[model samples]
Target chain A: MKGVVFVKLSEFVEETWGLALWDELLQEADLASDGIYTTVCVYDDQEFFSLVSLIGNKKGITVAQAQKAFGEWIFTELYAIAPPGAHDFVDIFEFLHGVQNVIHVEVKKLNPDGLLPEFDFLFESEKTLRFHYKSPRKLCYFCEGLIYGLSKHVNQEVTVSHVECEHNNDDRCVLEVSKVG
Target chain B: MDKNPPPEALDIQLLKRKIEREQKARQIAEQQLEVHSREIYQTNLSLKKSLDYAKKKNAEIEYLTKASYDVSSELTLFDILQSTVALTGRFFNAAHGINAIFDGQKVQPNSKPLIWSSGGFWDQNIELQSFFFKHFPLERAGAPPEWLIMPIDENDRIEGQSFRWIVCINFELGNDSSVWIGFLSKSELIDEEALNVLEIAKGHLRSGIRRRLSDARTVRRNIELQETATHLEDARKQLIQSERMASLGELAAGVAHEINNPIGYIRANLQVLDDYLKEFKSTFKLIEEKVNLTGSLSKQEFTDTANKQDLNFLLEDAESILKSNLEGVERVKEIVEGLKSFSHAGDDNLKQISIYECVGTALRVVANEFKYQHQIINELEKTLPNILSNYGQLQQVFVNLLINSAHSMPDGGTLKIYSELSGKNLLIHVEDTGVGMDEQTKNQIFNPFFTTKPVGKGTGLGLSVTYAILEAQHISIVVDSTLGKGTCFTLGFTVD
Candidate 1:
């Protein structure tokens, strides 16, 4: 995991729940990073899971819900610093396609060793898009939330369905998204 | 203060942490820029190398194109050698050139090479020859390769031009000579690219020399063939003339026979007349003696001698003999005149000669040939217009035809000669009912060296000469023949 993810997640938690709750979650997390993350450095992924678990325990939510909330926050935060190409795509599907294709390629160049999930896409139709994903982290809920967050940014209504998830019997996750009528 | 810090103290601590995090992010951003800058520099370096290689290759291609065009355009070997050396020097920045041409194995002759400096043509040809003789003698003839590069000989630099290395390319010139075109470089070694460019020029020069030499040989061969044809033509003309002489000889023999018959009877008649005159003279002489001059006998003696001589019968027979002798003399005169006209070999000027007269003269020339073996049929029109033609040549044409007709009738077949006036033309036909030729033989009868007669009996140039004479007169001949029946030769002489 890249330190940027941790830095953005911490920023999201502090902004949504205030600095006192973020300080409390950091204290309880017992992280290797000690809740100090910089965007250029790498950190242990387990420490990231611990931080999210701490946030979930303190906020009276499951770890999946905490992770989903962090994913949504980071999507908007990342778009605020999006490249010129990302802003050119007006539709949610176009934006999501650009993120995986254009943005991810550029991002990979910057952080080649970052533990990013690999995605294979099928634009089943103009109205539907499916993302086949595989990762050791198995962050299916986080990717689903990222799709919902992109739809929010474009003000487009889309239904994100987990056709298959690593958490279930499936070996890899397939998220099928459809535009709302 | 309470157990937790007050708002001012907590806000100061939070402000300090925010500043520290901002400083750290700036440091990381600067490090990323350095790594990206190194990668960008590497990519630019790779692109530069590729562009340089492409440019070098393009130069080599352009050089080869120009070099080949320059070499191949020259037709002569000397011009090709000079042009190739000049192109090589200009291409590789060479300062001077030297070319030598001589024979190697006759299959290829090297271009006689005199070292040509950048200044002008080499005037010292003898000196250059001596230099090559002293160094690369004829004994070095092992049939060298197409190209060679050697260090400039320190022993001999005739003009002393400070030439570094010499690149010599050679190809065949002619059977008697070889050619060498050498480019003299300056100080520096030529690079691989320039060497590759020279290889292309070598290929063009090799084939150019070969093609130009082959072309020269072809031109020479054409001239030789033309000369041979001219000699053959001269020989054929001479043979046709000999054939004409042979015809004249035959005519002479025939006229001799005709003249001898008339002369023989004329001489006998004269001898009889001489004896009768002598008797009369003796009787007269006896009377003259009594009257005047000698007075050797009496008048009565003269009367007795005259009475004994039988004067009336002698006088009458003498008149008949004298008349016969006069007719015989006229016949001999006519035969001699005919021989004179037929034997006029130089009478070649075109004139309006009567076709009937020409045929008559020809028949008379060969009259003896026809007398014993063949029957003659002459139905020629005397009123036919005279043709504008050489009299002697036409005479030769008609005589050859009449003789050939007579010869064909070996076992006494009919010989028929006639004339007809077609539109603007007079057609003379000579027919024979002898051994006639087939279509193949008929077609070839007029060709030189074509003969149906026995080898010693015929020169085979008779009809060929006839055809040549007719063609010169712008007259056409057509022969119609059947194997068993007869043959007719029609000469169509256009009347002017």
Candidate 2:
């Protein structure tokens, strides 16, 4: 996990709840970086989940909801890291398709130390785009939230579902995104 | 409080963002640099591999080129095979080699097993010969395998200069014949690439051998042609002499008549002379009686006896008959002399002789062939310089020319024989104003058995024999003929 993810999350927390709440979550959580994250550094994966859980508890929500919201909130910030052709996708499905081919290649070049997920596609139909997401991190919910954010940014209607899940002991997660009427 | 920070605080925030941006840019640049370096390293490695391959191929090409030169430089098949053995022995890292060939004539080939070795040529070993034939059989049932490997006396000994292992490769030509190149070494020589190159070298070797063999065959055929030419020369000379006598035989009737006419007259005149001798004897007896008995006889009785014998007429007629008989005998002798001179055989020694004599003898022998319609204009210069030539053969040459000319003029054309002087050379021209030949026939006039006369009318060897005889004397002959005009044969003799 790059520190850029944490930095984007902190900005999202501070912008929504104010700097005071953001600091309270960071001070309470045991972070090696003391929650002073820089984009160029790599931090512990558990530390990221721990901070997300702490914020979820304070807001009286489930950890899944908080993580999902954080993924949606931090989408625009992470979108900045995408290489040129990954932007301006016509819809959320197009953006998801570009994630593996266009965005990930450039991301790997920039942060080679980061363990990126393997992305393969199955064009089940013209409207339905199914992609197999295989990663040790198993961030399926976060990926769903990213899709939700991308749909809003591109101003197109989309429905996201999963035919298989890593959480259910499948080797990879197959997320199916479809255009909505 | 304002949502925007103070100017000093804004400056610090802007500076932090600037530092992070610069750090990220530097990291991407470093990543690109490493990737490019790795690619360059891989390219360098590939180029090195390609260079190695090219060097190996170049070495192979040079080796085959050297072998080609070796194969071509040698003149004989044995030498070529020997040279190939030397080249391949070193190339395949062998200690010894043997080359054998079968010439397809007989099962027992002219197989000289020329062994090449680092030491020298073949060191003859009777045991090795037996061992070789045992492995490579003389009458193997089918086409032999491309290669064969067999173990030699494997006693690990180099002192006796024998190999432990041997590889025999066979290059087969047509006619169940092949050239076998066998290499021997203490260790196995199993370089496949070298063997592949050896196959290409085999092509050069096969053609080189083919050329060498073709050369050898040509030389052999040339010798045979020379021998045939010699035999033909001898036969031709014999035929020329025979033809001289044969033509005379053809004229035998005319010659016999020329002799018989004079003999018939001389015989009749001798009978008369005998009678006259008897009459003179009677008269002499009468005279003797008159002188002895009365010492004087009457003129009336003498006159009466003389008139009874007709002495005046006998005296005049008998002298005339004796003179004519003597001239007849001389005519027979001249014809016989001509026959003897014309038919002299095998006397091909050159002597200084003029063309006029040859023409004269040729005319006398072939005179009966001419007719009242045929005109013999012997324009041969009597004072022509004498040239070196065989007398009998030259006369036969002229006889053949005259007969051919006479035959050409079947309807009785002029047969003009003449000679000219040109720069210390004598040129005899035998021309006929008959049905002349075209350019094509004129070109082949001197070739053997080439003639315009019908099948049985000509042997076609007249001008060929004449040309051969003249050629032997270092003389030149040319034919100038045109259709419906005339044909002339010019013999030029360098007579300085």
Best-fitting candidate, scored by TM-score: 1
Candidate 2 clash pair list:
none
**Compared with the true structure, what per-residue lDDT tens digits does model 1 show for residues B374-404?**
7898998788787798877787788898888
Model 1, native contacts kept: 0.09
Give the Å error, residue A2, model 1: 44
Off by over 4 Å in 1: A1-181, B1-76, B79-93, B104-113, B125-145, B153-160, B174-176, B191-200, B241-255, B272-357, B372-397, B407-414, B421-426, B433-476, B482-485, B494-496
Worst 10 residues of 1 chain A by lDDT: A32-41
Clashes of 2: 0
iRMS of each prediction in angstroms?
2.8, 7.4
Model 1 chain B is weakest, by summed lDDT over 10 consecutive residues, at B105-114
Cα error, candidate 2, residue B187 (Å): 3.3
TM-score for chain A, candidates 1 onward in order: 0.91, 0.90
Per-model chain B TM-scores are: 0.62, 0.62
Estimate, for each residue in B303-378, the C-alpha lDDT of model 2 and write its tens digit. 8777877777888888998899889888777777777887778567888987788778778777767788999899
The C-alpha TM-scores of every prediction are 0.50, 0.49
